[model samples]
Target: MIDNSLGEQYLRIYDELNFDNQASRRVGFCTLENYYATVMEHVGTEVLNTGIDIFGENLAEQWTVTKQILETVDREPPSEFEGILQEVKKHRGNLYHNFREDIPQRRLDAIRDVAEEWRAWLIDCAREYWDTFGAYTLEDFDYIANEINDYSQAYMGDIALKLPTIKRELDYAFRTIAKQRHRRLHYLETPDIFLYDLMPNKTSSEISKISTTYGKIGMMASKIKKGEEIDTDEGEDLMYDARNILISICEQEDPFGRTFNNLHSSE
Candidate 1:
């Protein structure tokens, strides 16, 4: 019943995402530009890596990488994904070259929604790819659970030195807050979680934690808006009330939790 935001869970075969698209550290509850960058950074990198793995290092560009992933997986992406990719490119162009300061909130939210859907599809395709080639996917003795094993294993020797740091990073990822599907399931299982509604001050610490988590998410957005890599924590919780609260907001508004993003907006 763990939330998907725990990035370590995906350490076995693929790296789809640790959290849902909107509340993830990648998007950081920020603006559309950050959301767009996050989608491209995660999805684009994965697709590009798949291409370089399957088709070798001559991968052309970001859009080409997405197409290559679709072809490699032998799964046709939905037609809407193509248009979404175009928007992704447009966002990237606007984010980088043109650098506009003015964009409509509705448009940004819409783009965030589109990017989330597109990334979800990409994750599905990646899962299919991993499932398909997982058996014969090793190169000699280079197999590692989640990492690509087709290449050389020269770095394996460093494992002795890096294991502690890796564990620390994972611990951080597990505690960071975000959107997750499992939040609803867990909430449904334990109605007592609603007791906090009856006695709000009883769980003041919990409320503070959620607020802090949300603040971290927003910080991530600001960092991404400035084109910084996602650097933050993934806070763990006993009941995952934080994630559920955000998901609830998304349900009332739209799929990508734009309500929370627009909470501070004048619009």
Candidate 2:
């Protein structure tokens, strides 16, 4: 039997490794997952049917989707692989792991614009490669390549694979913080309403950070309460405040605890 201590360490190490892969793996018809699957499949065998099976195998192997794409392709490829890869690198963090920053919908739409084109182009290239060099005819390849753009196993699964877990966690935290902070800022009017969780070992510096963050949250609430015109900067400040407060929970800091030390712990 494996030692429990060693097992714990091993699991921790493994999780960290996957966590660091934040910049690497990606999902979707336009991501490295689909690109590598199409290229390597054509390299090894004729791509038939939706490219889902090949992408699935890549996932099973725990490959970093984008890195695998780079490794499989030459210094250059005919398709816009480089462009797709660049967009992935730029937004993958914000879209997937960046719970700290709420990405603008317009920005996500811009990235999706490129990704959709990449998906369509990738199928085009796959068909050409299969017809010219692979063991498949033009008609056979066309049928398969066409379905690559269809709703297949690989399509959404590829993109979902990169994000779901972190996205879910980040989303929950974001909503909870937004709601609670809003309550403190407007409904309760007192800091104590939503500041129950406290870190016993919180330092003065950390408390200062929380205070500043809390003030920002309150500012957002104030705007809402006043029925004033809240602009983009104010909206972003609310998001930042919510994210910071959620972060304190993870840091085990009793935010504001240091500043109000003399008050009763219950209070």
Candidate 3:
């Protein structure tokens, strides 16, 4: 039996390793599930008569995108051999004296194996359905691929591109900081001071530059709020500067978080 302290440590390690993976896995599973359902709905009576050959090389080609999406989300499909090995280990553990040496590692390995198998099984079920009912011909594959790609692009792009969505994100950030600082949003008119106060680690010169750019953005946001016209070129420049500021700060604090290195690169 594992001691409480060791078990807790193992749990912490598992949580840390799976933090982003859990979200990615869930998203991947959901995407595959929806894809399967869509294909089945479209195929209808064609499913029973359809064979893998009917898809030609189209389904095989489309699988590239499916695999790409999974990889983008960091989804790792489980290995059947690994699952079998885990089962054998579990049976052995039951039949003989439990291996006490490195028990935490063994326990963690078993949990990871089981978790992987569970996610893989979920994805496999969807893939099986999709493979069976997805496409009747090359044309079908083309249509389905186009539809799925469009949906995926639109869904992901809207998160950061839309003004309302951006405002909501910014508002949430501000409200969170406001609560932390015990300040009200209605009274928080000067973003320059508020931002300066929050970013104490920044040099005064850097804060001054940020304040100046922020003032321009603030004015643009005000015009937007009041349904007034603004210059598109000015708005785009402000957007670039704001993004560059974030990139610069993140690059200093967390090299890994910098998505783009060229601050002056055109959007």
- Assess each prediction's global lDDT (C-alpha) against the native: 0.38, 0.38, 0.41
Give the clashing residue pairs of candidate 3, or none.
Answer: none
Instruction: Give per-residue CA lDDT, model 2, range 1-267, as digits (tens).
Output: 111121133223322332223232222212433433444343222222223445455432322332343333332243454654555455545555654444344433354444435444444444443333332233432333343323223333222232232233333443343332222233134333234433334566665565555565555445555665555554554444444454444433111221212222434
- Taking the tens digit of each residue's C-alpha lDDT, what string does model 3 give over 1-267? 111121233334444443244343333322332333233222321222222331333323333334443443354444653453344344434433533322233543544444434433434443344333331223432333443344444333322243333334334544543443334665246756666554445777887787677666666777777777777777666655555444333222111111122322422
Model 1's TM-score against the true structure? 0.33
Model 3 has a clash total of 0
Q: Write the per-residue lDDT of candidate 1 for residues 80-156, one digit (tens) a residue.
A: 76665565455445544533333444444454455546556666665555334421122211212222221123233
Candidate numbers sorted by TM-score from highest down: 1, 3, 2
**Which candidate leads in TM-score?**
1
Model 3 misplacement above 4 A? 1-168, 177-187, 245-267
Cα displacement (Å) at residue 165, model 3: 4.5
Candidate achieving higher TM-score, 1 or 2: 1
In candidate 1, list every pair of residues with a backbone clash: 5-18, 28-217, 175-234, 175-235, 175-236, 176-233, 176-234, 176-235, 177-235
